[model samples]
Target: MSVAARIAGPDLHETSVAPRSRSRMLALVIALAFAAVGGQLVRLAWQNEDASTIRVSMMSSPANTLARPDIVDRNGRLLATDVQMPSLYADPLLIQDADEAAERLVRLFPQIDVRELRQSLADKSRRFVWVRRGLSPAMAQRVHNLGIPGLLFVDEIRRTYPAGRLGGHILGRVDIDNRGTGGIERYIDEIGASEAAVGARLSARAPVRLSLDLGVMHALDEELAGAMVRYEAAGAAGLVMDVLTGEVVASVSRPGVDPAVYEDALDPSRIDRIAAGTYELGSIMKLVTVAMALEMGRSLDSMVDTAEPLKAGRFTIEDLHPLGRPMSVSEVFIHSSNVGAGQLALSAGAATQKAFLQKLGLWSALKTEVSSGPAPQKPQQIGRIEQITLSFGHGLATTPLQFAAASAALMNGGTRVTPTFMALDGEAPVVRGERVVSARTSALLREVMRRNVTDPAGTGRRADVPGFEVGGKTGTAEMAAKGGYRKKSVLASFIGTFPSSEPRYVTLILLFEPKGQDVTGGEITAGRNAAPTTARIIERIAPLLGVPAKSL
Candidate 1:
């Protein structure tokens, strides 16, 4: 063989073999890498898309939206909260064995009616069915252990009022879908939900802070509850407010609902008597009349004849407990004389009386949107009959909140600050309010009211607090129904303030349909029921409000 030919042939063959070997190695590595990547993608998709991975939420109902944000007392104690709950539901379509699922569920949750559950699940026409709402974690765990495929577990938010029935009327309750229906809940739902509806669920703000103090609320609730027991009263309601700031520090309405379960709260009467109910608050009118007369240039020394009844049309106005003689403006308040208050209203004239009340925010419903009470009548077209009757808190029905706000105005330098449910800022915001009386007149009225409650001989002696310098007026009005005045039923109310010289807080307590008893001296009047309750509340709440005992 020729040497050149042999060298060329060998070199060419070696180069071809090396090219083929390198191509095979590259292809093998590329294939292995592609397989690893594909496996990772599949594993990720399976992990994220598992059947149990889906989370669902039920729609919120309008009625349920009224459920208020959490309500916290001033000290940050939880008065109310929204508890996380697990609910049992069924996809009838998925439930192949309805009878088995229902039986198993009922066996686990004894509270559930097995027969009813079976019937409900058997109704296949209904795609979605609720087994129950508000299940506990333990209950949820048991239900999960059943492991029945078609039965589903859904998470729900239910309102939990830890205070139980305490402050129920004030905090209110929500509907099943977690919307606020009444009380603070209703107020917050109306104002608190827009931002929460976004996807930022974790960013959802906390429940609202109320002007209420939980400690104060607890004390008031206890005192009123005791009164209900002691007086054998049909029901009782009480409230306290910062006169200068319009903050409700404590409120109680007996027969309140348990937010945890409102459906079973059968007695509809447990609704807020202070905000939704109306009353012909009687001598409580004296507070208005006194403020009216003083603003019209009448002095505390101004005298009115109260020895006998005042004849008006067919009506004769007399003090419940007659003074038996002329009464000074101060004496009129102390005696709680209807004759004297009527005279003041008449002398002030309808226009002036109406104007005074309108300024005091009494001519209209109280400005609180949380209210459901009837609006106060505006002097029935502003005339004499209406004015005279309104003077004694008759012929006009106002919610207790209206009476409280007006009384606060009378004591807070005559400036009517619309009552507020929102928490006050660290320092209260200064709002220019309507002036109902001159500063001097308001001062004089405060003095008169003080003497009425604190004076030993005053009609409201029961309302007196030894060192707190209690000042208030009593009202015992006959309850008027469509037929006529309820012969035996009365609305007993006491409206007043404390440290009368420099007023800080205003409070009121009311009793509805209190039965006459020996303990009440057969009077069944506000002086007997509402007055004493108000006194008890002040005695307990004074320290909370930072009200010092009067200096000796």
Candidate 2:
């Protein structure tokens, strides 16, 4: 620079301003520009960032994001959902005196345990602590008015059961932390992926439309509840389904719990009896026994020598009301003859009986995941005794749904449709089956089953619907406990179908441990309780299901 300056002489030096002054000016301008830029950057970030995310937390907890999806009935009526509420929390370190804060919090939240609060505060190592959840707006406002230091309020969501105990078992419940703990909640949480959750338009919307109808569900529950109260039943369960679609229109297990207050339920007996509990279905097995025999070659007119009780190794086969005369296949069903069923099953053989039952979808668990019901217990090795017991529904155990579907197979053109709890798409008859029997055989079986209810002196005369052409079979099974059958404890159930001339829907009703009353005619049979319930349900839902009255 000195050499170049010398070449230009004094002109170059004078033209350029003094170095000290130029340097100071440049430094000042640079500093001012940076300050202005920094201010704008801060303003932009403050305006655009999602403040809701940063409001209370930087490192968030899963509990903070806990929210449930919605639950709706088949008709889109809101059955269960969630609502946001204010929750009180505290920064224990910021609190001046833990004792003072505890005293004040107890005044506001009397339900809060003072000892627990003090203990939580004593652990000052904790940065934040939950004071209370599910706070009402009024209570939240009152707490906030206190203006206590270290106190904080956060918005928390609480589950609300809109229909109360109407569909309690189906909808299930969630824990206090806002996670699905049971029933549909657990179902959704399993399928609710993170992407689905984030892209969802509504806040925690998992609207599940079940096949349940509230009107039908309430009606069924009311009838079962009445029987439970009137007969002093230990418990009861009932189900109504569309025979064609395997769609359960109504299912009830009582005494039911209220989902709104899950903690109040103390009766462990309140567990779902139909879906979760399993039992030897008793004479109901006779339906499968007769179906298997007919499917094989034993005809409706085929006769079984029931003139004498069939003798086995040590156990002899008999009937509830054994006819001391030769009983035809139809008589076997009408009389509910155990000896006849066992002999018929033995003649049909275990392989044929197992194949037909397996075809009817009785060997495996149902596909519907709404309940945790056990699978139908398969016959052990299909022996002579096993075949005999299986024939009359003794050695085998099945869920009520399984029993219903198997019975439906006999009525619904011999097609085995997988039972579901979701509504059917339309009225179109979409069949899924392996053709367990020819349509001709099914039609013949229907005619014989009809005689069990419509004909006078039929055992199921109580299940007759005046103009509906009803047909069905009655089952009264003794409760099998850990050791053996329990005396005086019975599961009274009836399985039936309407328009038997051209069968449409199959219905079943079950009453567990119904008490005997003087009004019960000295008998607490399925006919007295479950059969009448089935009749009433059929009368009410038939019109709704679009089944027309046909001249028989």
Candidate 3:
């Protein structure tokens, strides 16, 4: 490295040299380490922002805010972190000519309004006008060479998501001040993890480890993105959660937003569909309905009348394919019989159905570290139509995150689950939440859920992963338009629990506005799209989660 290059970071104002006595040795070792990896560092903080190139400018503001602690995945992979970057600011009084300065700066940063910059520079009264914040090393060097008077660079701390867009929604974002703005970043601030009072250096505080496994998150993202392409879907979302602890191991929504890109977070299309947005979720909700029936003294084999369509005032409740005969409750779930589910709901009465849903925590909003999930939109009054439609996952809307949590509870021996994004250490107290249903009910639901996948004619048979014992349900609901549901545009979804005999994880996958492509035999149903997508994810992620595959 050149003497002058070592003296500065990228190209910024030179400062009194920071001690290089031991840093040179550290830099040499890092270079050797990078060389071992073919010059591609997997960006684990110090490894990426090489000590050889970066020099923290000895500049401080009156209030030099904290260098936020590093964020890592469950397996100690870097996610979000603070790296020293030079932020450009200006002192209006020092600028020689406002017009010239603005014109010169605008050449480097076209995004900066030349008129506004000129006015700010001309104002002699104002001192510390921010020219720009969070400039890359090369970009900072280009701006520094501009030699515009009054332009100054400070060694400000900036938050960076090194994993790029992977786990972006959950990693959250920070402000120009490195303060948490949204997602887990905001959660850190709420919990007082960002103690900025310490000097502006890397936080000595322990890295905030999240429950997200980078490997599992990457698998989930790749599969969901691929599903969108293969099925010609408008959007897709998926997540994997530990049924026992409600720890979300992997959650993804596409097209995903990069936390580093400020404007990407603002785009409506790029919203985190798993947690931030709510939908009717279609028939996967029948899992709750089935669980409720089991809790209400009904056995899986109990017969439910399904010979004719059930009426709820103006709307008639009918199955996609009616059996035209009484059917066992187990068959009802496997076939995804809307008429059977409605009959069960009617038999339980609206009050019972409403209370059962409340017990499962499906009626209210579910709050996690990432978001305060929007409350499910349900009928103002629990009339007959509302009761029947809700049983079949209509007339109610909920965040996929919330629905996943409820599903986890039913599979996890009926305990109420509170989903968390934080990694739970082995020593961390694992207190089981309140029981939502009897263990017997949970066992029966798990059995039925498994049967739904294993049954030859089951709606969810396509989701089966050999040796993984995948048990799941499929839902294909018409997307609601302004007036009524659009039959052509459907939301395909599947919810699965793996190693069904003893589920360790619950997975939920949703595909919005999927088209009837030739691959699906020109059908936009969850059985054809979402179910198979779930199988692909479970196949890849089961090994990552350390779940051994049993001989089928």
Clashes of 3: 0
Q: For every candidate structure, what is the RMSD over all alpha carbons to the true structure, in angstroms?
A: 7.0, 5.5, 16.7
Point to the candidate with the largest lDDT.
3
Best first by lDDT, ranked: 3, 1, 2
Tens digits of per-residue lDDT for model 3, 1-552 = 456566556444333343464477789999998787863554555475565334433233445576678999999999988887878889999988999988988988999999998999999999989989878999989987887778898776778888999998888898877788899999999998887743346777899999999999999999998999999999999999999898999999999989999999999999999998989988998988888889899999999999999997887888878889999999999999999989888889999999988887788998889888778888899988888899999989988988999999999998988999999986878789999899999999999999998889999999999999999999988888999999899999999999999999999999999998898999999999999999999999999999999986
Candidate lDDT scores, in order, read: 0.77, 0.76, 0.89
What tens digits encode model 2's per-residue C-alpha lDDT throughout 234-339? Answer: 8888777776778777778887878767763445778766666666777767888888877776679989989888888898877667669998999888888888
- Candidate 2 backbone clash number: 0
Off by more than 4 A, model 2: 1-66, 94-112, 138-149, 193-206, 263-267, 427-431, 502-504, 544-552
Off by over 4 Å in 1: 1-69, 91-97, 107-116, 123-128, 145-149, 193-203, 264-267, 377-384
Model 2: what TM-score?
Answer: 0.83
Task: Estimate TM-scores for all models.
Answer: 0.82, 0.83, 0.87
How many Å off is the CA of 178 in candidate 3? 1.7
